[model samples]
Target chain A: MPKLLEISKPFIVLVEGKDDAEMLYSLTHSMGMPKDEFQVLQYGGKQKFPSFLKQITNFPEFEMVTKLAIFRDADENSQSAFQSIEHHLKSSDLIPQDSVPTHSGEVKKSDSGFAVGIYITPDCSNKGALETLLLDSLTSEMKSEIETYVTQAEKSLSTDRARDKYKNSTKSRTYAYSALFENASFHDTFNKRLWDWSHPTFNQLKTFLQAF
Target chain B: MPLVQSVHFSNYRNFTDFTMDGLQRINLIVGDSNVGKTGLLEGLVTLWGNEEQFKALPNTFRMSYGDYTTSLDSFWSWLHPQRNHSLTMILRSTDIDNLMRAVRYEDHVRYDRDSVERSLQKTPYKINILPIGIGNYEFQVDLFNQLANTKNGKESLVSSLQVIEPRLKGLDYLKLPSSNHAMVYADVDLDYKIPTTQFGHGFTRSMEMLSNLILSGSDIMIADEIENGIHYSALGSVWKAIIDYAVKNDVQVFATTHSRECIAAAHEAMSEQENYELNVIRLQNRKGEVVAINHNKEDIETAFDLGLPLR
Candidate 1:
């Protein structure tokens, strides 16, 4: 019989919640690497970011995590969400793309060693559109809640001021989730799932470890 | 050259136990006459005699404490009229491994039949000669004891003549041609064989000092009252020669005296020369105790200008 391939690498997975941590754990277990070869940790939430940042910065393998993936729920308050999380990175001079000035020096002066991204369940077009999309879900109760939430988010996005605020809130949520995920991997496994839907690539997480 | 680095005594005189340190070729013992200055020198002479290799003198001479009384028991009556007398010494030498050894009294026998022993108020007199070098060859014969008020008590007072080796008997004596009379040897026994007693005290003292210098190999020479009979003109030359010998042989000197000329002589010897380190320990007798008043070259000059007695 042909032998099974083995992974002899130490990896860590960072996530925001125990649920996310368990989810990442399950994903990597099914992936090529054994669950034992990687570590996993959850930062709990954004409130712990500063302490987590300090704790992670001291790791000798801090720069080795190959990938630092972020996962956050994009609620309709973009600007508020950005405000809640942007201070730490701002002080570090990492101006987010949305906040950056067009001047070339601005980016050079403000870029920190981190990236930002957001995940949002796209908004329906009309008043009854969310309710119809909800019908496609297997759990009718969850579908209804999603429908209600999406409707509220869409209404909040209707005005430009509200829309910017919602976008910022969603962006902060994603940044917070990513920060949690990275901090978790710093404390535990590196090649584990980052969110319920996405796993941190071994190569990406390995970058944080500095050694493959 | 006759510097005494240190002196130790154990029953040699009134010093039941005494030591002298920071010695020089000239040492001043300037207290009341009875405070045991000459007695100390007598003890040193006895110690020198005990060492046969350096047999500067014969072991037959035992040191006796020179005080007013003829008997040891009556010494208290003559001096303090209250306290009994006993003395001990421990001399230190860099050349000797056992740096200190005691000089003690060795002959004591109890006789109840004797009339004096029966009437005695205190314990019978006992003299012990402490063993030096642990029973190795006449080590126990260094001390001579004089006990009082006993019929059998033998008065064994040996002369200080043993300070130097006994001359090959009769070698020091010469028969005069006229009547074949024999003349005693002098320190400077040149052609005329001038008896040391007939020679100038300075010459005789220098000769004696030179003989000691050759014998002791002492780094420190301490002469108490170095000006005893020294001539003023020869004083400077004598000091210079002594210092020269000390420097060449790695010796130091401590001398004490009440003579102003002697102080000037030492100053002249030291000031006009280099190489030999010099200091004077002026002694001040307060009440019944003697304490040193130390002075360096500058201090000595200042004190001299003030007409203060260095002794």
Candidate 2:
């Protein structure tokens, strides 16, 4: 179900799901941002952006919203994902009707004078997702071990459909790594510090957030 | 169509230029105190209600008889924003000829009706505003008499009330030998008839609300703080009854609430229907001015589950 965003901070971030929300929550804290400076909202998924954005725009508390940021997966194409977020923002009249921001991490002024920013995961140029970003932050030894375990089990126990579905997915690989520690969720990896946040790989995302 | 399809307010009470469009049949207004939820209802009454309903605004505002005396100029100026005599309070609605407006300037108020309404100034339709902070006992006889006249409506009321209290069997309107006024009696699980006053306010208030809604024959019903008399537990059943009756009778309801339970119960009840018709309008104070934010069925459900601060 599409859930409404609870506005508790002047600056807000709209993420795709619980994993994305949890990822950003701890990631921002790792960057030394105050816990209350930004409110991370799980809008269910990228598919629910329309209804969820409608809820946010119609919420009375949104009057106090001075800044907004959208986090999505680069997933096949980073530019297209940024454009999609821009379309939804314009459709809900959150931004100027015809105005478009030039870059992925650029913070632009909304129609109501609030700052709006968009960031696609795994860097602005990569054709990957948050899982790819997470995997990049892990030690090469741990990454190789998790990958070997998933590959070794896939040939024996995986169905044809599962193989075809996850042929290029980092989600299964990341999940396998999280499972190594008693099968915690991908979001739980953040709290466990399974991913190194200080890595230069997270510089772009951190910059986008700090701009707000 | 609902009586007021959309509304616009300018210099009306706490609102300077607030407009809430896409009005639904069932609207529940939520806001912090002094956000002008009552003022919105009064604006509706000013546009759709009859002369009696207009005159009853002071009482609906919870003002005592002394506070509303004609000698007090402050009472009249208080309707304007900041009590500024220079500013005129204007309320416009889409129902009447695309431009039904009530302008309140100083102590003089005027409502111009288009050709569509032959009796707009003294409309036959009543707003049926059940006020708060006042005893509803004054209308027991009148409401009971109206309810008794319609057998089908009365049966619907009984069945709906049973959802809240299963023991309720029937309702009786009996007049005491000495007094001319009559009172409502509940023939519940007991062998004898007992006055509804003997029951809890939840039962009595629910019974009164449904009875007044069905019997009053008002196209619009404005209830202030609907959850006042009812307990939190019975909120779901009461909402179910209200929504059912409102939809079946084509009556538009505008109610205000301070309880989160009331909001959740309303969402639960409306979501049960195949075609959801619930709209939760929340008013908030942004800086010194107030604004209206309208939420549709799915929007309200999302806010409810997420525990969004709507009120």
Candidate 3:
């Protein structure tokens, strides 16, 4: 386990959709990363952001989280939810007013070394810009099939939207999109071709950590 | 299988007769207010609890028509003081699944002198409810030991509770709180703790169904209105636990509820469970006699359309 001097590797509280949490944990563990290193909490859906926050605050480990990340879909209410958290924290004097990020993907650090980030993106591009870019290159027939399938699965789309907004990263969205499409017929279609644009997000995550 | 699957007798207060027939893994009894939802459970309690236990109405508190009826009046029967009851449970042999193959009531014969100088004696009623052969047989133990013998050892009853727990292997320790003496196996042990007094109305009524089901090893146990006071969120888990345990122990259960959550939980359980047969009985009152409307896949949609709440 990587340690920051006497400081433990910060607990990255990832409160995302249920399937997203499951996939994240699975992906993390598959890469030899211990699940316990970052508590991957499931939010069920973005409708429960307030309750999720309240529940997480109740847990004893809430204060120990050196990095508090809010990953949700950029639904109609995502901006309000992000602002709610920032407002609540600012009012509570937990985070400096200036430190609260104004836009998605922008990192803001608190006085106590605690950091917060927001991920808000369009629903269609939830698999991130890269995966969406890859999907863009697909045949019109394939695009229509994906859209039609997604349109029918509106419930799953809402959940995917919440996740996309939370991670605030097109890269994470691409991962999610991959997961969603992994079982679909399009997986083989883009299986070999999409890596050029999509592989770098995970590689960037590794690089970012190594540099830090 | 129960010939009369569910019975709802009210207005007479203590003279409720809620019985059912041909019980399955999951049975739903639906009826209007005062139609004997709780009354049905009372009958099962009486049948499973034992004749002696039922006779000593003072000792064994009974719930009738969704309300606890503690004081015994000449409501059930005037001829027999013992039969002045609220409910009676008649179960089919096949529904039992040979889990508790034999259940023989202990002899309860006591002589008492009436004010008229007439000698009154308690008669021992012996009936083998289980089949002649099959099932993991154990000694037919009296749950209400005191009813049989005033000086019945508490340890003996406690030992019986312990004896029954291991036979039902799927029981998780987390779900069941343990006893100091032993794990309570019989219906008596489970009901002993249920605060059935009118004072503990909420506690009494809430746990009454679960308490009776656990204590009485009746294969086809019936309970009306499962989520009385328990939160709807918690009711799902409680029902799941009970259903899971029942399915594993080969116990068929019939529970009626007006709450949509309870119906949803039962429906969800049915969808997940393939082996269980879930039948919803909607009682239609015509004049004075009540007729049950059973819903199956063929007419479930129609039944739902008729406001039967078939989930």
Candidate 4:
């Protein structure tokens, strides 16, 4: 759902990877935002944020861009992720180079309506990833059932080497939930609208999308 | 350190008030077609060259795809925005003291000063333009003749040729009685001295360009579509020769390319050098103005790793 090479829209939303981009594509659409209002692009990984930021600013369409949104996972530290985006944003040749917003769901607008913003997943302040947000969106009964299935699946493994992959992995838990629906892919779960897009857990992320 | 630290162009072929600073010794310009790649090279040659060069090479430096209008009196006439013919084109670089300004009147071009000309004459370097097909075979023979006059120039040519063809034993210029004209030949350790052109386009292309860099004794070498004739397998070797010769002689080289392999080869070649002095300058046409985006060594390496749309 997310475009890779060219940026046809005036407003760009940079995601961490392809799955994030594809998920945000339907998420933003479900949030009542106009389809042509923005474009979501993947930078492959968070370590390449500076390189991607430096390169996109050189595009001819960048001059016409009025807003930039960075969506990366919190992973370990949310503040650090936000700071990384802020550092590269200031270094870029974006119009009205200024400070980025420090808090999530807040937008800093330039005098020319050219603003740059950031939103770290999952829940903006948590030390987790997009899968954490997806897992929280499930109903209480469904969440417990999926967690038990993932725990027992880890016990069935032959060795701790194979079991280590499931330990502290919200990704494996999310995949287990998606596996219930005909073995859909990571993005297919997002594309097929299998997840509860209108869940209250997405309120902060929805608010962040409104800033662009 | 860069020789020409910065350059500002005022009304030079649709590039109105564009400044490209942070120039390195070796720069590769890339962009969409007709975005002033060749114009940047030509503008530099005119800004740093003398009146003799302008008279002798008015249209030779242009790319084959540029708008070649015969109605214009000379290349200088088109330097003006919309060809008004009344404005003076001013080119300023950090290395030179005076601004090189020129105006075209009724039939010819006029300059106010020749400081850049005198400065070039005093130095041991000049400007050489190598467009696609550099020159004819006879022209290559002439270059070989010039380079042979100096010490080790002949051996250098043979060894550099060995980069693409290891069997090459020697290079010579001969005008045999049976031949219609004089030309250059290669000794590929075969039975007879094979004509260089008889080898292949890649070999002849590499021979002409590698020799031109050494034989012309140019301080600045401008090439267009550097990967035109050479094959993909030999791109790395050709790039090594260009980088080595350019660094050894402190020559400022500007080459344009549309091939990713060419860009990678140039980047790879510079990586082996002691110091990294390569920059990829991409010109983008926004609205009506030409904008330049310079990617240094780190940026280029990132582009390669991420598959960025740098070209």
What's the TM-score of chain A alone for every prediction? Answer: 0.37, 0.86, 0.52, 0.91
User: Which candidate order results from sorting by lDDT in descending order?
Assistant: 4, 2, 3, 1
The local lDDT score (0 to 100) that residue B167 gets in candidate 1 is 31
lDDT (0 to 1) per candidate: 0.39, 0.74, 0.42, 0.76
Q: Give the per-residue lDDT digits (tens) of candidate 1, residues B30-146.
A: 433455654454445344322332122112122335432343343222222124233212332221222333333322111121333244332221211111113211211111111
Model 4, span A1-212: residue lDDT tens: 12226768888888888789878888977887877888887787887778778788778777878888888888899888777777777676554665367676567887778777788889878888899999999998998998788777777889877876657478978888888889688789988989888999998888777756
Every model's DockQ: 0.00, 0.31, 0.01, 0.32
Which DockQ-derived CAPRI band holds candidate 2?
Answer: acceptable
Flag clash pairs in model 4: none
Give the local distance difference test score of model 1.
Answer: 0.39
Better of 3 and 4 by DockQ: 4
Let me know the TM-score candidate 4 reaches against the reference structure.
0.83
Question: In model 3, which regions exceed 4 Å deviation?
Answer: A1-212, B1-22, B45-49, B56-74, B78-220, B297-311
lDDT of 4 by residue, B206-235 (tens): 778878877766788888788877887777
Best by lDDT: 4
lDDT for B31 (candidate 3): 60
Candidate 3's residue-wise lDDT over B170-244, tens digit each? Answer: 211111445343222323334333211221222222223333344444555544455555566555545554565
lDDT of 2 by residue, A1-212 (tens): 24434677878888888898888878888998877887888776666676677777666667777888888888999999988888787677545553345678888775667788888887877788898988887888988888788778767765778777655359988888888777568788888776778998888888888877
Q: TM-score per candidate, in order? A: 0.32, 0.81, 0.33, 0.83
